[model samples]
Target chain A: MDWISLILIPAIKSLILVIVLLTGFAYATWFERKLIGRFQQRIGPNRAWTFGLGHPIADALKMIFKEEIVPSYVDKILFVMAPGLAIVPALLIFAVVPVGPNITLFGREIPLVVADVNIGLLWVLAVAGVGVYGIILGGWASNNKYSLLGALRTSAQMLSYELPMGVLLIAILLTTALGTADGAGTLSLVQIVNMELPWYIRIWILLAFPLYFITMLAETSRKPFDFPETENELVAGFQTEYGSIKFALFYMTEYLHILGASGVAVSVFFGGWRGPFVEQAPILGVFYFAAKLIAMVFLFIWVSASVPRPRYDQLLRFCWTFLFPVSLVYLAITAAIVILL
Target chain B: MAVSDGIKGAVEIAKSMAVTLRALLAGPLTVQYPEQPIAIYPRFRARHELRRYGNGLERCIGCMLCEAACPTGAIHVEAAENDPEHPVSPGERYAKVWEVNLMRCIFCGDCETACPVEAVVLGHEYELAGYSRDDLLWTKERLLEPTRPNVIIRTE
Candidate 1:
């Protein structure tokens, strides 16, 4: 392919992916509200525009019109940069995600991905880690004691949970190696998922799925684990001082991260874009991807509504004493099994 | 004592779970709101609407009885001399400007009961959200009956 075509193709595909992801995020909020409302025996937004389809639009308009407040005590530069820092990495992480297999479009065989890097999984982890800087900066810049405390809690929580998360990834890697003839393994999600393995072997990996899922929830700062900005406790949390488009950016970043996290979880655990009948039609890869995404999103909402927030001390102890040790033991067991079997 | 406490705890958990499990099996409690509103009781106090006589004239008569009965002082009534060319009511005076500060009004239904002529009555509406505080305060023009048909009246 020519240089122009190469750049243009990827750029256009990335733009399309971003647009699709954002639209899904918008509806996800609506879905969460509706689902949570039902769970609580209350009606969600129903009067925005024609059965609340226009609720997001109404919300966007309201946010746009709102006065962007910057407190006098805040560090203006970092406060301004924080939301962008949060959102950019979230968008970037999806670049390496393989949505589908290669398809011939107008005689040109186009890969259904933006950029399939060799170390896609590690890249995702790294970018996700970087995304925490936004929260940290936001908390510190706000100049409120609550914001600072929340930020500190978030930093500690993210750091603590990450150890287990990384160890779990190590377990998946070992499984991938055992499935392969050679000891060398691929960290790419697509490659790992495409491995032709028996049910018995796959079952071992399946056991680790819940552990990874719980860690992902904590990593994304989702409900039950969402203590950083718990409305009842922290008022508005880190972005309490933010307003207007800036606040909107933070909101958008949150939904985007949710989408990214769900995508990663589906790719890693349930097998990415590999549908029951997807072998017949490769195009069904998109359908499988969307189904998995929706299922994961629903799980997030379910847990959010069902579970109560853990106390801060309890959260830390759960991470260190329970999760960390369990994941380490799991990693060791998987490694031992792979070596013996 | 520990054994008894364990039994009591199990029983309490069972009771709570029973309530939850029964609710799970039952039909969804979600009221679709705009699509399907809940059945309001007959005495449900909502926003106030001005009543009209058979001849299409108002029945207020500038009495201010409802205004006096409102404990929150939400009602504001201005009396004006009735003109024969454009008489608004049967009495010598009519309410020129009727306003209700809904923020202050407790929806006690006292105003409705106090009105002898039943001119001011609360209608069936509970939605009262607004972008600003000013939007909540109802003026006479907004509270009056619509001149056109099929007009959806908003009430608090």
Candidate 2:
């Protein structure tokens, strides 16, 4: 029973999670292209099948058959390993994310997550923090100037944005914890989602939403803050030296990271899997969770499409000068309110 | 900058996003050619062709004005006396040899204008790709009986 509960179920969940994430990563590209195309008044990828549904398959085939090129005078091992490093953390970040409530399968109750650890939120933060290593190492190993510059930019950007994002999340957690029946705060994401909060606290947390949104965008290295891989200057940044499947792996990491970030955002803000008729039919919770996740991703894409990328100095200055102070003020305000209430 | 400036910037971004959303609703400006018939002007000059009168007599008098008028020297004409018993054209002389090197033709419509009897015309069959240069060297026979259908939209 212990083996079935602890190891077998989790292993099955992890396998399913990876398969779903990979497929999501593939189609996310298609969705982004189609949506951005519409935004620009252009039809995107209608050649293969209706509305280019088979585009991802065609792209995968192209990537697989492409010749892998390893430049001379490059650190071959780290260059090869960088993409793997980048993708592993991205995939791992989703492990703690509860997609839906516990459901009975084969006469056994199972939590719809790979891991529901007590320190689930901390795990997400830590795992997300590791994603930069892939970019840094990839850029460093390429033995190219542009790659190194991109890597350097990435490290700086991460350092600047991580603080506000962490602070905003802490503020949110404080509000959620304080508003609950018991004063004891929990770091488990599922518990946070399930907590019932009063209107004042919900409104207070909503005040922190914009800062969180900006930080999340910067953290994911999406457009408008994508200085690390800006095509104009970096020529694909860290991925300059990578080609074929290796390049595809890096591309997969970028999209999968977006999915993970969006999933976390949904759980933290949108009340994960909580919807009308969801409690009665737990299966509907999965659909709600998926719908929320897609909506979050769409918001991300919409922001990217709307905003233009800032200059490197401007990006850093915006983070340090504006975002950092604003979040600090927010955190101080939240702490004071919690103490007073 | 002031807080008001920041608010203004946010408002501007919202406006731009609204503009883009409106564009999204306007549908794509793409012309899906080959599947759909494209609208081209009636005067759109594309390929050269020879013409005939109602009586089926060739309109060309072999004047060679088109060859002179052609800026690229894409046209060539040779004239010959028509047979007394059966005239190839209403005029005494008819075109013995006429060819247009499409490789050099610029589709300027000068040849159409230069012809005294309106023997030459630019048609609406512009999909002129061929495997070799020889295929594009339209001779008298080819120009006299063009196989492709002309598609011209009369704006008037």
Candidate 3:
């Protein structure tokens, strides 16, 4: 009975999460292309099935059939290993993300999350930063000048943005503490989400929300902050020499991280999986969480289409000089406010 | 920067976003060629076609007016006396061989303007891809659209 509750159920939940995330990543790529196309007043990729639904499937098939290329200049072992290293953390981070409340299954209750750890927030942030190691290793292993340069830029950007992202997240934790009586805050995402939030408003316009989003975009290495892979300068940067399935793995890791980060954001900032009829019907909680995720991913695509990539030096300077100091001060203010009031 | 400058920047960004959003809702403006082609403009010059009169007699009198007017030397005409049994033209002289090298044709509609009897005019069949160079050198028959024997129009 204990094994059934602890081991078997958790294993099943993890498997389900991996399957859901993989499908989401594939569909997210198609959704981004479609939205970007509409923004540019063009019908992008309408050939593959209806509304190009089979495009991701076709892309996967093409990737599988493509000839694998490993440059003689690259370190063989690390070059082969880097993609898996980069992709694993992205898959592992979702273990703590809950989509719905615990429900009875065969006379036993099972939590929706794979692992609802006490330090879920910290666990996510910690694992999220580990994906950069794969990028660094991949760049270093490639033995190309452009790859090394991309690695340097990525590490520096991660250093610059990750701090502010963490700090602002702490500020959000402080906000959550104010709504509680004991002045103690749980880092568990599900616990944080179950708490009462304030009235309807533009939460994104708030300082912490905007700061978190901007930093997360940089963290995801997406557009407007896509300096490492900026085609004009780096010529695909770290991924220049990689081809076939290895390159596909890197691409998959990226979209997975974006979706996972959005999940975290939805859980923390917005009341995740908490909406009308969600309490009575736990299945509806999953729908609410998904709807919010889609909205966030839509904004991600919209912003990418609307803006151009920033110059590398300018991006670093903005992060260090402006965002870093502002987020630090905001964190300090929130901590002080939480203590005094 | 001043607070007003920040506000102005936000407004400008939003305004540009609004324009793109409107365009998104307006739907795509693509004309899918060969599948769903757009209607060609009325005066658009395309492939050349030899005309025939209502009595089914060819209008070309073999006067060599079009051959003389063509700038690229695309038009070629040869004159011969009309046969008594099976006359091709109403005029005494008829064209024995008429050809237009489509590769050299600039679609200028000059031959149509030069003709006194409206015998030659550029028509609306624009899809002109061919595998070999000889296929592009349109002969008299290839240039003309097939005319039906009975009504020469679609039935109701």
Most DockQ-accurate candidate: 2
Stretches of candidate 1 exceeding 4 Å from the true structure: B1-156
Which CAPRI quality tier does the interface of model 1 achieve? incorrect
Candidates, DockQ? 0.13, 0.62, 0.45
**All candidates' TM-scores?**
0.74, 0.96, 0.93
Count of backbone collisions in candidate 3: 0
RMSD of 1: 7.3
Please provide, for model 1 over A194-257, each residue's C-alpha lDDT reduced to its tens digit, 9 standing for 90 to 100.
7766677688888888778778888888887987888888887887778898888878878788
Q: Which parts of model 2 are misplaced by more than 4 Å?
A: B146-156
What local lDDT score does residue B46 receive in model 1, on the 0 to 100 scale?
80
- lDDT, candidates in the order shown: 0.81, 0.89, 0.83
TM-score of chain B of each: 0.76, 0.91, 0.86
lDDT tens digits, residue span A1-341, model 3: 68888688888888889999888889999998898888888888788999999999999999999999999989999999999999999998878888888777798787788888999999998898899988988999999999888888888998889988988888878777655567587788988877764542125216477668889889989987886677888898788889999999999988998899899988888778888987688888889999999999987877787666878887887777777787888888777766776
Worst 10 residues of 2 chain A by lDDT: A172-181
Q: Would you list the rank order by DockQ, best first?
A: 2, 3, 1
Pick by lDDT: 1 or 3, better one: 3
Summing lDDT over every window of 10 consecutive residues in candidate 3 chain B, give the lowest-scoring window.
B147-156
